[model samples]
Target: MSKVDVQLADVSISPVQYQAQLLAALQMRDLDKFTQLLDHCRVDAFSSVLESACREADCAQFVQQLLQHGADPNILNPVLLQTPLHITAELGCYETLQVLLCDDKINVDALDWLGNTALHYAAQNKDQDTVLALLEHGSYIGSRNHAGDMPVSDIEPETLEKFLNTRLKMPNDESLLFKYDFLVPPVALDSALLKNKLSDEKDNVIKKLSSPSPEMDPIVQISLSSKQQHLLLHPIISSFVHLKWQHVQKFYYYNLAFYVFFVLLVTFIILHHHITAIDEHRKSCWLNLSAVCFFKIIMITLLAICCFCLIFKLLFQVCISPVQYLHKWSTYPQLVLTLLTINVLFIDSGTGDSAVTVITLFLAWTRLLLLTGEHPAISICFHMFQKISCTFLKHLAWYSLLIIAFSLSFYALFHDSKAYIAEKNVSSKLFHNPLISFFTTVSMFVGGFETKFLPFETASGTSHIIFIMFMFFLTLVLLNMFTGLAVSHVQNVQSKSELVRLTAEVNAVFDIEKLVLGNPVCIHMWMRRLNLSHNAVIVGIFKSFVYLWLSFSWLQCFRNIHHSVLLFPDSSFDYANIVYPFGNSVNVTWNYRLDHKVLLQAANIVQKKNDEARQQLDCWAVFESYEERLNNIEASQLRCEALQQEILQLLRLR
Candidate 1:
């Protein structure tokens, strides 16, 4: 056909005809014809034709040509929602698959009409190369298809064994390097060397900056400031946003210890204050006063530290997003504790020791239990309790209103009755008071009132019948209804235990992120310094002396008593030589030092790795910000272009 005839013929043909011609050209491997047909076809027609080509054998070059011409690799089949990647994977077209997989825009795990990913189809057919290609491109092996089967589940036994044995090699292709930058493995360092290097660097910096140095370079000063900023901000980033699992677990243990100590110290202070109030003789004693003063100082110091940490955390949350900060359940507890601690500091104990302060202390202790929501069993129980309590309270509110109305009417009717007045015992008179009457009636729902104390015993016959009806409705009907509702809610909670636990755990993690990680000063940093200090040696010696003295004093007191008992273990392991089941024994004296050193080295390695991961994540976050900005600019440009076109149309009409 002549060029004019070819162009006219393409225009005159239906969509099916064009698709057939394009497919024929693709299958024949006629690049020139394929290129011509693509030029005359629309994107939808070209996509359908390209998908058909993927299904045919040895059409890899045609697929490449289509892709190079800007044909989409992700276009779905109209019926199956299958992309060319999925089709090629299913048909075992390895060459075509390779071309499609190389395209960054192609989704390696794209699902079809059956919700089967490309990997799913490949695994089903036992297509080894296609499966490897998909996996290399980051396809998820655990994803369930429509039939609820994982890709691995579809493979034959032999193929499954092979897959299990296969070790996925990291992609080293230069083209894919940028795609996997975030997955870059951190550089490993010798644990002992890393610690020494870090300490030496810090000491050198401190020594150089201790005095004014006119010779210090401006670049060096900026670098030092940047390093300090990174060290200060790394914990917040790692715990809150990135939430690396290992780092989270480490922080959890650290915070758990600190929180437990805080709770115990607070409890001790509360009990001591109560004891001093009751025992004036003990309060007057020198030892008692000194102990109280010492404990008070420790409690105040701990409270101050916690308040300082909380202030920084609050500021960080508010700075990040005020609305989200307020919405979090954990924020309220911290805010209350902060306010209460500040209030307690300013107000005298004599003036401030009211029910409110007591309640605040209780709340502070209860908040500690919330941290245990990270445990699945604790989280499930918490969810069930929350659900049941909410349901019961809602029903109770309505039940209370109805019961209160009836109680009020009964009080009005019987207030002046001679029989009621004559039966004015302490319990009987409670119903005469309005507030007490409401509670009394509520108590009746739980069968709290005796038959002799019932309002009907003193009222008129008509009032007696009304009272019976009210009791039946409130106690029998509404109470049972409330119980049933709570039971239903409990069942629902049980069914969704996993989901609820996950949500609770996530919230707990976020709370920890805010409270622990968001602290301006890292507690672990001070702990490490304290552990390496000479003063720690002196403190340890003093602690040992005090413990020994207390034990001796306790033993002396027991000897003075007529009745005393002590239990000793029947079996104990010898410390000199530790024996194993294999009859191998190591001299504890020699192995103790070696084992301790090895443990210290291992700990240092883990700490170093975590620090490196945090640094890498910070770098990745910076790149992500740049990427987001570029996307915004592209979107803005498209919007501006459309507006410009609209303005041009309006001007032409005018």
Candidate 2:
């Protein structure tokens, strides 16, 4: 009898012998013998053996016969917890895998002990045909393995190409036929694998399943987290903080409206205070004390809330180093306003009526103008002023010494003349006071002198001569020198206006980022409180309106008027161009920049070629690795052959 026939004949006699017979029939490609052996043995007793044969022999007919005879194709191995499909995919048994897939009972996405599916194995092995077959049989592409990697992620370029091409070529109509109805199965741990239940292996498996997937890009994850955290804070300011520059430009009008409202409210409060002071001065009972106090309280409360917002912003700026934070121009004004607010809140109410308080209020109002720096006219004016101030300070040291010498010389010569002018009531006493004499002399140089009030007739001739020289030096020489310095600074600022404007915008964005987006802990706590408040909706709406108003330009109308004047100048009127189609010739410059366009196109083409070359190199590397693995397998097979020859020689000697 043939070996397969003899094995089949003895199948009923022994379970082990029956499995051996079934493997022999599959290896020989004897479909009849394989089917007969399967029939003789119980389905469960020989199903695993049939699966092993299918994996090893590359026999599709044996797998099909076993499936027809009621062998469970989805049966997992006791040791590895892997199904026959996983084995076939790993071994590159494409035909056997196809046969197994035809049976709907098999779980194609079944996870092995490592949480890897059949498709993952196929991709890992770079078996293009097997990958395509698995994909055609409704395999999920996004299934993640234990390593948090999708089947196609981090694979060889050649294998990735095969996967992409197969997906692309799949017809829309045929896709419905292979639609997967995915249902995750509970993981079943093998008793042999998990013999010691308290071992680290169990904990490892649990941790693997519980951990977040590493498939997300790190940058995308961080951006998403930041967005979520911001959403939990004050949503309106968060929106403004994250707005694109183009959108911010378009939305400036809304912000302007907010600033106007804030300024009007402040004006109303100041007027109320003035009226209250007038009533007290006249000793009239026109205003009720209680009503005035209540009004003051309401205004103070509103100011306090505004101050709180500013303080929150300052806290965020604390993330930056002290020197860096102090370097910003806006920080100084903000700090002053914050300190003024704190003083008003903690000190006596009468302090708000003091001259210092009034001066501080005026400063706070002026600081609001800084928000309009985005306007070109305002930005240029500010740049010019800053330059002039810096230049003035650089020259102040030498100018001070010259003024001091003239003042001391005049005071010494005119000291005795004060007695003679005392009866005339001409205030010649200024010469007796050193500090006052210095100011009076400087003022006289600037054309503040009144000859009727001066005792020049009574003073000595030396004093008169010294005063004339001082006036000439201070007015003609020093005044003109300062004027020339200021003019030079304006010219320098105008030449570099665009650079200054860009730098201001960048600095503004950095400050806003520090204030609005920094301090996650504070934002989180404030958000929590905001969420719990009953008036949150009304407060949010009001806050949004106020914030939008503050962000807008109060002088936008004037800026627009300036822009119009520049566009249509009275001196250089282009009447012919205005009447004709070509109103302005400036747009032609944009089209003339062909060099830039050509350079951009060349860069794009070069980038595409580089990407293609990199892909080719990756494919070559994969092939080289495969060749190395094949060489190792061949060497191992030769060693086994030599050992077999030695065993035969030992048997012959015995």
| C-alpha TM-scores of all predictions | 0.45, 0.40
1-654 per-residue lDDT for model 2 (tens digits)? 322223334434777777787878776778788777776666655777756766664577777887877778878887677889998988888888889999988877786766678988987887888877776665655555444455644244454333332322112321111111111111221222223321344354333222221111211112234232222122111211222222234335444555555555555655565566564632333344566566666776776676676676576475423445777677787687667646745563333556645755686677667667555347888878767877877777768788788778767766555533445645446666678778877776667765344556655587678767776788888889889988888888888665455444334443332332232222222223332245856656644543342344563343223222111112121210111112223122112211223223323434454577789999899989999999999999999999999999999999
Error of 1 at 514 (Å): 7.7
Error in Å for residue 274 of model 1: 5.1
Indicate the TM-score of model 1. Answer: 0.45
Give the Å shift of residue 439 in candidate 1. 2.0
All models: lDDT?
0.55, 0.54
What would the per-residue lDDT of candidate 1 be over residues 217-242, giving only the tens digit for each residue? Answer: 11112113422212111221111112
Off by over 4 Å in 1: 1-30, 33-63, 66-100, 103-136, 139-247, 268-289, 320-323, 348-350, 414-428, 449-451, 455-458, 491-654
Model 2 / residue 61 / CA error / Å: 49
